[model samples]
Target: MDALPIAPYIPQHVKELLNVSIKLIRFQYIDYSGILRCRVLTASFCLEQDQNVKFVGTGPAALYASYVEGTDTTPVAAACRLVPDWSSFRVCTYAARHASVMCRIYETLNSFGFRRCPRTCLYKVLEIAEKELRCTFLGGYEIEVVFMDVTKSPPTPFKNVVEWSLMEGLRGRPIEILEQIAESLEAANISVQQLHTEGSQGLFEITTGPLRLMEATDALVYTHETIKTICDKHGLVATCFPKPSAAKGLVGQHLHLSISSLENDPIEARTVDAYIAGILSHLRAICAFTLPSHDSYTRVQDRRGTNGTWVTWGTEFRDVPLRKIESTHWEIRCMDGTANVYLAVAALIAAGIDGIRSGRKLSWGDSQKSPSLMTDSAREELGIKTRLPLSLKEALGAIKTDLTLSSTMSQSLVEKYIKIKTEEAESLEKMSPEERTELGIKYF
Candidate 1:
């Protein structure tokens, strides 16, 4: 159906987010890939507390078009939660875009079939984080994305060059849009760090200082929208698609996460080892969430023996599924700009936290080369178990059956995720491999 854009009273949502009285309400929805897309309206207590308010659709928010035909008739859908930390002023925000086009979006917190979408799935993960981890996860994230031409008329290499070379120095659709985003982020309580071009052509990365988990994710949502607006103004497209099915270049959102102690401690102790174990143990399965696309497998392949293996690990090799950095946390390399930011971050944190709570031993996988760079046997023995699923079906099977993971992660979320991913695979299966790769949306 028809989605009517609505932007009224959204400022009230923003006001509540800021005051100690209002809780943080997040408005969230699902796009075509069944990934959660969001717009963080605001965190607040009372509308009376503020006179000025701001609303925005973050980078993750730009994933869905308000006017897609046939499916997802509901557009105005929203889900809101109070920040676990703030019980007094209680900051609550809707993950909504405030445009009239979002009218059909469901708003009830307990609505059934609502959880069918990944947004709700994310909510479920947060719930688990609360009960099991027994710690409040707060911190900002660094997200990377690539912008380029994929409309098929022709590839514009210079546009990509301009995006990388001139983003911050000059002012254009890219910079102007990001400036609005930076402003919106500051208003939302998320801090912005510096960002720049990444390895792939047309690629860009935004690094925000460590944020409370809520604000960090919110920053992602805002950045997504700002980038989209800038692209549209310049008659360009900025996509978060994992492998846009085109040679436009690889696009994936990398997550740099650190968990501070809710218990007032600064370090997580062996929490690092435990987190590593859970991630490595469940990595093959985690691939379903991290890389989430058929085109992804192809991206992992080497052009001339340059690309190798099913999984790799390293402090250096970028191809590895798990990359430990000099910093306090690990950088998951397999994820691409393709998947949902909320979903990827939630899945990873859930897995990592699961390891911590269960006292799971994170076998320090090989540090020599990338997990993708090493032999399968060598990787497997060092707790690099379970080959990364080449197919979405395989990944679903892995996650669905893992007794340890299932106990913590929602089974409903699993079923819903599988349903969405299965449809994606089936749709792609209709086309030949060449056709699939050439669909040219942006990833493989």
Candidate 2:
């Protein structure tokens, strides 16, 4: 186990406490399908080893290609190594007798970074942002999940009232589940800024405080796992599926972002404007990563207020795709729970960096009316030229043609991502809507 560069920042007292308290260490990573996977080793194993690196088969990466369903010829079919990032080390509050940490994947013999690794991809983009743009990105995710009654034949929403932030909605099991989730997240050092019921029955949202790019996304992954684990222990099913049903409203994983200089000052207006312009310019292509599933498109429709269909932005308008919260921050609404948070954030950073470099200007003004409600002539007058891609196939096609976004991601990763998602889209085309929803809940 190779020690992380963050070891220097760990206080000696905290280090000693961890060394004494932890019995097992879990090295976790998110797969291409956005599922959290882990490999566990005894604490003594890490303490005894000079370098904390652990070797594991790369079969997990092949999971996106359905390697388990059939044969896998992907590069990830070989052996690889997990290099622990000590900065991400967290004491597991949900599970006793173990601690968890995230790892960067590297090829065993060649010592090359795995191209398809989401964490590494994010780090590369962040590095470019800091080095070239001279800025630091801070972000947090607003996670929305539904609690289901598993005892029913088909799981149903746990609450009957379909109200937003209503106390009546949280009267029973929902409140207890949410309280436990908040406690568990706080215990793991992941702060929950707010937790409340959403518009959909049994749907709740958790808002977390901001952190640097990598830490924010990594914390979200841990947060989701904690919610699901605790919910299961209480005999309820917690799902972040974007649209659990057509009758119910949509659920989203909205990303809130802000940028600041190395000196910790808020970015200038010109720089901030260009950064947003860049994102809006490449949003359709970026959607290939942020909204990865066929069902994801189902949630990103017009008039939903959850996510808009057009590529426009506004000041605190929920109907627009990008809602400007403050001079320094904006909320990206197109993303859903199914997205791989690391890849999604990386794509946004890549787009923003390009925008900054190119000095892009905002081509359109803010619109208070939802694009879906606006007349064609109104949209034309505002310079809103295109609507967002309506399907997974269309979104993938947009990425294929997007030179700017394609250049930002590694060619190998983009190719593999398209291949895996294309296959998924094709497969979904043959399934019934109910079948598709069931499968999405199981994996996403």
Encode model 1's per-residue lDDT on 300-351: one tens digit a residue.
Answer: 5532122233454566445556556743555666666456555666676677
lDDT (tens digit, per residue) of candidate 2 on 1-444: 222232223335435655798788788887666667778877666654423433544544433544123224446435565666667888889988777878776654443356666777888888888887898988888999988786875667775577888888888877888899999998887879998888887889999999887888889988988988899899888888877765566878999998888765767899988999899999898999898887888777777787678889888899878998898889999998888778888889889888999999988788888977888899888768778888989999988888777678666677767888787778777778877767766665
The estimated TM-scores of all candidates read 0.68, 0.92
TM-score (C-alpha) between model 1 and the true structure: 0.68
CA RMSD for every model?
A: 8.2, 3.0
lDDT of 1 at 221: 56
Off by over 4 Å in 1: 1-28, 31-124, 130-132, 149-189, 245-248, 302-312, 371-385, 432-444
| Model 1 Cα shift for residue 146 (angstroms) | 3.3
Model number with the top lDDT:
2
What local lDDT score does residue 96 receive in model 2, on the 0 to 100 scale?
A: 86
For candidate 2, what is the lDDT?
A: 0.78
Count of residue pairs whose backbone atoms collide, per candidate: 76, 5
